[model samples]
Target: MRNGKATIHDIAEKLKVTASTVSRALNDNPRISDATKKRVLKAAKDLNYQPNNIAAALRSGRSKLIGVVVPTANRNFFSSVIRGIEEFANSLNYKVVISQSYDDFEKEKQTIEALLNVQVDGIIASLGKTTKNVDHFKKIISKGIPLVLFDRVTNDLDVSQVVIDDYYGAFQATEHLITEGCRRILHFTSAQNINIYKDRKRGYEDALLKHGIGVDPELILFSDMQLEDGRRIMQETLDRKIEFDAVFSSSDYSVMGAMQVLKENGLNIPQDVKLVGFGNEPFTSFTEPTLTTVDQKSIPMGQITAETFFEILNQKDQGSIIPKKTILKPELIIRNSSINKEN
Candidate 1:
């Protein structure tokens, strides 16, 4: 009846019942008799009746939908987090709408606006690299919508966040390299505009200071942490004759690039130059020499993010929910890449 779709009125007409009775029966109202409810359900099935969720949402003032924004869905870390979010949200009978920012600030703002237009109940997001100004996110708070940040978050926002201890993760990785006798360790990292990368850089520096190794400014190279950037940086380091015994990259892709350059120059891994990477990407384990890296507990982070949103929803006043910061500990995964041959 509504745009050629079967409606409660159609079911009522087929069953020779009033539309109100059919509606109550379809909703399983206790006032409806069991026989009548069964009959209405059967008629609905026969007519293929479908309830309009948008209409129901308008009536109830709740969409039962959650929006998730990530930098990229292609990366294993984000994908795994999404899977965990889906798992928990589905269990609670909630649906999730996902949007990818692609690390672009404009795209991120557009996606958030689109999600808001659809009247989602809540949003969970990781800030994009280019998202320096967070006024757009503040707008979500202004609209009384619950927002939770994960992974790459900003301290300027007073919202719930789920993240790993990136500082400790980097510290452990750097200290591991030092223990393996890597004196002149070159750090391949990304821009410090993002909080996660900044924490990693600080951790790397602190680890060196703790182990009596002075931080070398020339050895700390900043890049986009892409494969090509890694390759280019490594080649330039070689061209400049920079002395380094180990390479600690903030990204697995960057490590792969460095590995390629090292291999081409006939440098043996763990013998000539030890290596370590972050993210614990799948490829790290299967490489010629498995990469030592840090596991960010991405799935757990996702689950916690969803759980926190649910808690926010339960509160009578959204603003009353205290700003929560949940930091999960990072685990160091040791492998062949950074282990000294003598050890």
Candidate 2:
């Protein structure tokens, strides 16, 4: 036994029986006599013989493991979600294996294949920006393995999805800017393929519409939610000679990049160009302007995802359960970015 892990051979030797006999006893084969079955089970318990899960999975077509696919571990939001998932999974005696897609569809495909090869009972996933073909996901579903999509889920799939109200959060933030007397507000968004981005963009649009302000397509720009992407976009805005009074970015890192560019231009934050960002990163408050942003309930989201997956897994023995889709509300955190002291 390695690291206190037991092998079937240990139990069979202890009971003076063949390894096959011990296996049959564990599986409750009718061929094994009751007395021998009891003796084998006692021996297994005494020696703490735990069957190899890999072999068991091959026989029963399932390993009590849950697979999770995320973009990356760099962000606090994703890390918190993983923590929540792990905690919930541990409490339920289930193991979790996580994979990083790095926003690459090919990496995602390979990760999913690896999880499936291990015979995971279920999968929890957040789609990458480059994920356009969902045929691989469909194939996983066809294998009778339940799938749960979260965060950046595909709009085309008819599957259960979990995420926050991005549109409302963005709308609220934009509206706050309008209330604060920002006549020219720029919106920095990410990929349009994902539902979260689409929702946030819709919110930005709706806020402008509600305020009776004319929508300027030129004021909106899309980036990859990276520091460099944010820096490039802000530089381009400056090159266009656009004098915007405020900027609302979809990501905190992007907001930071914009701030860096603005600071280098000798432009005072709030006094010159007010800013707001999404995803309440821990470092937001420490920024010079202190970013105003949206607080996505990440820990709860992760916990709920785990709970929902296990709820489905528990019901699998009975039959299919009614599909569940849960959407949580995001709260806006007002900071120096959107709120000028003079106002």
Candidate 1 to truth, TM: 0.92
- Please list the residue runs of candidate 2 whose C-alpha ends up more than 4 Å from where it truly belongs after superposition: 1-7, 10-51, 317-320
Q: Give the least accurate 10-residue stretch of model 2, judged by summed lDDT.
A: 315-324
Would you list the clashing residue pairs of candidate 2?
A: none
lDDT of 2 by residue, 1-343 (tens): 6688777787877778898998998889999999999998888888877677777888877677899999997798888888888999989777889899999999999999999888888899999988989988987777777788888887676667789999999999999999998878899987888888989999999999999988899999988988888899999999999879999888999989999999998999888888999999999989987889899899999999888877777774524556768998999999887787875
Which run of 10 residues does model 1 get worst, by summed lDDT? 51-60
- What is the TM-score of each predicted model, taking all chains together? 0.92, 0.87
- Among residues 3 or more apart in sequence or in different chains, the pairs in candidate 1 whose N, CA or C atoms overlap within 3 Å are none
Quote model 2's TM-score: 0.87
Per-model CA lDDT versus the true structure? 0.91, 0.87
